[model samples]
Target: MLTHLWRWTLFSYRAIWQIDIRARDPLHAARRAWDIQRDPDSPATVFDIIDEFGTTFRVDLAEDNPHLDAQPILATPPMPAWMARLLPRRFRRHRIRSRP
Candidate 1:
């Protein structure tokens, strides 16, 4: 019997998204937003993303955490003992706080 190696891969997809960008004018803002989306480190995900184009992407401004309303902010693991020792006591342990 042979064992198969498991791995995860990330795929890119095209979707319409609106982003609030601060710039001198509307055109500049749109350009800035486009640059951000083009960056490799952008946080955009393809999950539930549609391939259809020319469709409007509507978002309810009133709803916070619209897609992750039920998800809780998990606490981050503490820094290693050796790493913590190099920093001040206040910065040793860090935890992510939930929005009110």
Candidate 2:
């Protein structure tokens, strides 16, 4: 059996994320770690994010854990026009194309 886990910390203006995946059978921890590094957001895994105020949020796909069923917030962060210009042209085009 293999399982994935993640722990996150939030600082004043930065976020630190760490992930660990291990097996209960024959696979070595190193191999399990490699699998997790390849795709941190793969299906059937859990993701967690914590804020500075000690608020913990979790999204689990495992049957033994609780599930989150809330609607997503559709607001975008405010960015300066000049700062947006620093991104690659293709990324900017994709962002603009995705907007309604």
Candidate 3:
């Protein structure tokens, strides 16, 4: 699948970090963001997340910090409207192949 560089904005009482994650989409990026955040203290939380198209997502992290809402926010999908309009139907439906 095509990998996009996503920005995971981490918010903590200690500090804030803009973590970069490469993944197929925002959902994958959110998962990876939690994984990346494991190294830090528990105070750290996902403040904001954005896809390549810059669409913001409200990622609700669980108490254990594993599970998340199926829909990003208000039933919004990972891909943004702008991207959906830009890409072809097939490209939007199926993931693009990525090179090693």
Candidate 4:
């Protein structure tokens, strides 16, 4: 009976996205998480989440950092649509421009 229930639960379970803050230095990670949690409007620079099952997921700091402007060129405008289409499939340009 237990085996049958477990199988049913597993089949019905949906994966949830959570940040797991289990770094080499958990204290630092915890502090960062707390800061983000405290300020609801604060942009999350670093954090992790744990699921109900105790599974943890790491949120990439580099990807989350607002200061790090590394958005994909395809996502941005200013590049001519024709030029972007003309570029080779293998070529990807995502350079960060310095602001004056």
Instruction: Tell me, by TM-score, which candidate is best.
Output: 1
Best by lDDT: 3
- Give the candidates in order of lDDT, highest first: 3, 2, 1, 4
Off by more than 4 A, model 1? 1-14, 46-100
Clashing pairs in 4: 19-48, 19-49, 20-49, 20-57
Per-model TM-score versus the true fold: 0.31, 0.28, 0.25, 0.22
Candidate 3 per-residue lDDT, tens place, 29-61, comes to 998878777855554555555444334555445
Q: Rate the local accuracy (lDDT) of all candidates.
A: 0.47, 0.48, 0.53, 0.46
Work out candidate 1's RMSD over C-alphas: 16.8
Lowest summed lDDT window (length 10), candidate 2? 1-10
What's model 3's overall lDDT? 0.53
Give lDDT tens digits, candidate 2, residues 1-100: 1233332532532222356556676467667766765675755355554433333455555557465552323233334456668888776754442111
Residues forming the 10-long window of minimal summed lDDT in candidate 4: 68-77
Query: Positional deviation of 72 in candidate 3, in angstroms?
Result: 33
lDDT, candidate 4, 1-100, per-residue tens: 7767864572221222334575568788877667665776755545343333333344445453533233322322234445666667665366322111
Candidate 2 — which residues are off by over 4 angstroms? 1-30, 39-41, 60-100
